[model samples]
Target: IVYSWLFWYHSQLLTMKTEASVLVEVLDINDNSPVFENHPATVPVPEDHTVGDEVTSVNATDADSGFNGEVRYTLLGSAGRFSVDQETGVITLAAPLDRETQDEYRLVITAQDQGRPSHSATTTLDISVTDINDNAPIFSKQQYEATVSEHAEVRTNIIDIMATDKDDGENAIVTYHIVKQEPSSTPLAFTIDEESAH
Candidate 1:
């Protein structure tokens, strides 16, 4: 801005006069929008991970100064399973997760400034739920019954029992064991195949 004015000074014995113009500049405006930089597109979390654990972080920046440059973080579709720090942009787990029930989650993270007409930006986040050995193996049948003659051979096919687990990888692998029998026998009445459960 420029201003024009006239100034004069007079002394009792002498007279002097001066005139001058002045210019001023102003900076800073709420014109910049928040921008997300180098944030991950996808993240993986374990199903057995404890609640309130750190999942990941997001960052954003603005070119404006003061309150317009200050960014706040938020999660748009966390579904009560995740949360984000307003000032730090750190994401944390908010609830227990089960991969069997929900394998993945799609969310949007938002960054906004404090300007009068807040400027904001959004980023997509894909959170994949990794498998864990949290589910126990369940037997298809409660019990198995088989009858054999006293003169049966040493190796004989018996009733097959099966159990299933909802977990993945080695966690889903099921094996069989003969813990006990109804009546005690001198050399054990029957045997089972651990692999086939025969």
Candidate 2:
């Protein structure tokens, strides 16, 4: 009876029972940007970490959901001495690191989002490594020697030698090269520091 009445009195009924549904839509917002939890992450690799040695990583995170959360890494500024994975964020040492020539390096890493006109974030890294004494010191003067006056003070400046190297890390270790002094030459004729004055 009620079904029949509802069908017959639909146009005339003022107060009656009715069923309705509601629909809502949501929009996306750029509430957050990519960030590096810890800036200046660092690591050390052998002067020669083989051909495929994973050096370090650049960790980045996004606060958005879905595709917006996807982050990609890029080695910006200068891709020298390192390479970063676009997907995994793994940074690998491409060339050998020489501490004698370049003991430290500062790199900038960028993280971009997947969204259109994707947002980006950048960070700086301070990479410091130890010397391995692997690189043979190069005699800047090639070959040169001098003799001081026999009456000169026992302690005197005999020679000032310089050296250079090309490596990615500490493996480019450095030391002094004296090549045996003459009988009259003092034992303290030459000296070298582990750190580059640069």
Candidate 3:
């Protein structure tokens, strides 16, 4: 009986070979926030730009993969003047722009990932509305009446003429000139300063 039991045990040990062990690693979850790349902090746009025109584009990226890496854009405090593409991040003018009314616009752009708990990042987009020569110079008085003595000098300082332009920069710069004199043949008696419009 002992000899038979020993042989059975030896057979069982030979049958039970070495078992192999396997290991697997689990990936990380979405933890990184969206980030913008090579985007301009400030953009200059003409005030006369038509509606629906493309103002600028922004780009962002997420480190996570699959749905977690998908990013959407949002414009905060746009006030219907501008719109942004959620997928493309392209910003367009939604309303007419007027530098006279509002010279600059401060926009906050946000990029949010499509993860379960969305991660977002923000950037400041400063849009400066450039001036346009849309407004014409207007004189304060419709008509001018001045009295000059006959003995007045040729270079005597005449009444100071004032004109104002609503536009900005060079568009608003006013220059005084005598387009038409009282008498066509009369010599250039009066001269005004171009800079001061006097």
Candidate 4:
């Protein structure tokens, strides 16, 4: 009976000798903030662009996995004039653009992850609104009066005329021409400068 008991204890020890191993990998947490792909960002928009026109696109990336890597875009201080897509990061015009009203716009764009206690990054976008011809030239004075002697030289300098245009660049360029002259039957005796408009 002692030998039998010893055999049973040996069998129990052999069964207990069988062992297995396991592996556990700790996944990365949402620790990294979103990073902008572009720097010193700038976007050009025409002043005649409509409300739905697409201006530009912004991109960002996150190192984390799953929701932590997902990015959403937002535009700050646009005053409802611009919008960014949350998923695609495409920026579009939300309102009409007029360079005459506001020549340039500075916008702050942010990219945020969807993780809990979300991390975010920001970038500045400089939107330059190009000029468009929307205003006509207006003379400074409605009428001018000048007296000259009949013996005055043929190229005598008359009163200086001035006109202004609110537009910019070539749009604001003004050229002077005598559209209508008094004493229509009389020969033309006065000329105006094209460059100085005098």
Worst 10 residues of 4 by lDDT: 1-10
TM-score of 3: 0.81
Misplaced by over 4 Å in model 1 are 1-24, 148-155
RMSD of each: 5.1, 9.1, 9.0, 8.8
lDDT of 4 by residue, 1-198 (tens): 012111222355455543344455566678999999965567778888988878888899999888989999999978789999999888899999888889888989999999998999999899999988889999888988889889998878877889999899999999988877766645677888987966
- Per-model TM-score, in order, reads 0.78, 0.56, 0.81, 0.82
* Candidate 4 wrong stretches, greater than 4 Å: 1-28, 185-187
lDDT of 2 by residue, 1-198 (tens): 012222222335576556544444454555667988774466655454553467778788998766777898888643377788899888777777766577767778889888776788999876665566565555477776667787777546665556766543454555554466555466555444445421
Q: lDDT per residue, candidate 1, 1-198, as tens digits?
A: 234555555667766665555555555778999999886788999998889989999899999888989999989787899999999999999999989999889879999999989999999899999998888999888866778788777787656788899998888988887788769786777777777878
Which has the greatest lDDT? 1
Q: TM-score: which is higher, 1 or 3?
A: 3
Question: Between prediction 1 and prediction 4, which has the larger lDDT?
Answer: 1
Q: Using TM-score as the measure, which candidate wins?
A: 4
How many residue pairs clash in model 4? 0
Candidate 2 wrong stretches, greater than 4 Å:
1-25, 39-41, 77-79, 137-198
In candidate 1 the C-alpha lDDT for residue 60 amounts to: 94
| Model 3 C-alpha RMSD to native | 9.0
- The better candidate by TM-score, 1 or 2, is 1
